[model samples]
Target: MGAQHDKMEVGDLKQEANRASPVNIIVSPDGMMYDYLNLPGRVIINEEVGASGESLSTRKPVKIEKLYEYVSALRSNSFKFLLREYEELCEISPQCPQTVGLSEINQSKNRYGNIVPFDHSRVRLKPMMGKESDYINANFIPGYKNARAYIASQAPLPMTVNDHWRMIWQQRICIIVMITGLVERGRRKCELYWPKPGFPIKYGLVEVTNIKEEVRLDYLVRILRVKIGREKSPKSRHPILIHCSAGVGRTGTYVAIDRLIQEIQAKHRNVDIFNTVYDIRKSRSMMVQTVRQYMFIYDFHLDAWQIEGDPEGFKNRKMVERQKELDSKYKELTSKDDLMVEQKATYDLYELFLMAACCCCPFLFDKN
Candidate 1:
């Protein structure tokens, strides 16, 4: 009897083990390199993903890359699931503005003109808003909580250089992002739009003063001062203008990154990069052009958590959606003619009591 009991116990243990999760390892890549996470043994690349395994590090507001991984872990599927979710969402999303002509105001500069901001989202240059002038291919993409709102535009050409500055002045812009180099792969990408350090440049009524330039391995950040040199009242919206060769690839990527960074900072483990990008693309269809660029946002956030151990509004949204489904199901169950007929006597008595009670205590029922 003891031997047989031991054998049964061993069989039960094996069955439970079989039911456990098979993904003992998690892998995440940040464009250049990969980080592996081991769950069963608590060893990732021979080092702990987080040394303490608690939210020990008190990083300020948190960074996007790290925040993404923290939330991914909370979802229990890791970073891979996040990337797959984004890819599937984008793949299923319908490509809008089906006709190419609907997006383009100028046909010469852009090939297959990536839409000039949607009419509702377009930033009209004050100088050309009502005047007879070609449109500046630029858009204002609003981010979550109004964080990192941006105006994405193409690299200004020689003829449209003044128009680009006009858009900046009209929008009271502050930052100018030049993602593509002046010349890339022996091709002229964008005209030098900013003024030389000490020498201020003029374009129509706008004056561009290069205030600061911070260089990085991936991209450049330049602070620009655009003054109409005529407005009486002060407006505090210094909208950022981002541009690449065609204002589609790097331009969109940078814009999306800014929004993600701000959202992760604001919401911590609650924000969704996929939905954020989707919102931007709704306004400017070409934002975050490639799957690789989209994946990079996930990688960027994952890497932010690499140095230290880290920490779901996303799950709550899903819960709310599921609640809606349950509500509909309940409505169907209660409103069916068969159910009403089957329980008419009991339900009618209950309704009578409810109505009488409501009449007796008016405050118990909603007035509005």
Candidate 2:
């Protein structure tokens, strides 16, 4: 009788906690429950709840009206919220071993011994010149929609330059986003892999030429023309190579910000920094490596919301009109096809349009 009484007390406490909890628990038909911190959204299939229960992966429009309200509330305690989230992420983030990257045969291929890619997700180069081993210190990172949208790699060392180009050529990568200098603070962070503008250099059989470079106040954009033997590099939605000295710090931060920007533009309402970092770290450990970097992601999103969330700020602008047109078209396309694949394609196209705008008109975007 005493044991039964104790069980009843335990059940009562759990019920009380659930009632008092601020989070909303969403249970799908399959009995899978998803919890969000005060996030409210319309119920859908629920099998495909997105970063903040937005259901971006589905064709049907997921209600995100409450996300703006949540963001406003978050803004009131942004720093404190992010700090607590970061601490929690550090404790729960999963990681894998760098077995192959640290193997004796491939040790020299890594720029830093401690900063190696997970064996499971590392990019594998084709065996060349009769060499049996294929290795590079890089991992495939997922983008907002694409699973293999970006490659996070350590900056190339002197010996591994050829391998870097080989991976790029093999992967048919169109974009290369480097976030480090050749040297920093009296330390060599990366080796110069690209030729001078208008000059061509051959790394192994791959010929790379920097066709043009545009220098801005804060960032420089380079257009590269690459060729491999008889075939010229074709443009496609291939994985972009993004590297920093350690590959996880600035690389991760840049990728996170890029993904979040796409999310904000796509949904136009919600932003989930904690899950973004958590998801990226699962792919490549230690992504957004520092607390300051994590905070920067939040800062960037808040700044972006100021512009993107303001309908009046972009009134009478072509970008806004285009956005509205896309929204209408996206709804039409989703209604007709009713397939996830089609929905994904439309989402990717929308994200590409926003990225192109940011690239073409840096003045329009606040680079802070």
Q: State which candidate has the highest lDDT.
A: 2
Best model number under TM-score: 2
| TM-score to native of every candidate shown | 0.55, 0.65
lDDT of 1 by residue, 165-254 (tens): 777666666445555557643557678777866677778767767766665333344555556565521345456676766665566655
**Clash-forming residue pairs, model 1:** 64-301, 65-300, 65-301, 65-302, 66-301
Residue 211 Cα positional deviation in candidate 2, in Å, after optimal superposition:
1.8
**Candidate 2 lDDT over residue span 21-131, tens digit each:** 222233223222111211244211112222355433211222244433333333332222333345456656786888888789888877766667887788988975676
Model 2 residue 314 lDDT? 38
Model 1 C-alpha lDDT versus the unseen true structure: 0.48
Task: State the displacement of the C-alpha of residue 243, model 1, in Å, after optimal TM-score superposition.
Answer: 1.7
